[model samples]
Target: MDELMRRRVYGADHDDPDPGPRPGHVYVELVGGPLDGLLLDITGWPQDRLAVGAALGTELGKFGPGGRAVYGPTAAGPGRWAWEADSP
Candidate 1:
């Protein structure tokens, strides 16, 4: 959102979209491996699924066609999931 519009709708102090976790929505930061520094929105995902982490499929993977970027929750911090491995 533009600064003027943001100031009008979300107050002057709010310059950008809120990145904090909300009910039914969570944003995680990918910490390492190929897709580092990516912010993922994990809304509507089951708690169990989030706990175990996920194998996110990507076309830009090292293995190309059939690669999956595996990520898992870590003790690093809140909303931080580290790269576990890559699958082909």
Candidate 2:
């Protein structure tokens, strides 16, 4: 998990047909591990990309397979953000 966080996590917009341009939505997916393929959605975040990624990483550190976590939007606005544990 430490290694994963150290590496750059790729992100894309929800509506993007191609992996280009920044969108309001962002997500980080685990490549391999017990939580392999798990996706953490940070779309509702109104902060910069770095902040969103940090939040996602912090949440992920406390998460495990079969576990879940949800975050409410920051002062940015109102929206529900969630991290889902994908079934292996």
Q: Model 1 off-target regions past 4 Å? A: 1-24
Angstrom error of the Cα, residue 2, model 1: value is: 14
* lDDT tens per residue, model 1, 17-41: 6533334545677778776766566
Compose the digit string of candidate 2's lDDT tens values, residues 1-88: 4433333323344464554323454555543333344444555645765344332323233455433333323444332233332222
Worst 10-residue lDDT window, candidate 1: 4-13
- Candidate 1: C-alpha RMSD to true structure equals 8.9
Per-residue error (Å), model 2, residue 24: 6.4
Model 1 clash count equals 0
The runs of at least 3 residues in candidate 2 whose Cα sits more than 4 Å from the true structure, single-residue gaps closed, are: 1-24, 46-88
Compared with the true structure, all predictions reach lDDT values of 0.66, 0.39
Which has the greatest TM-score?
1
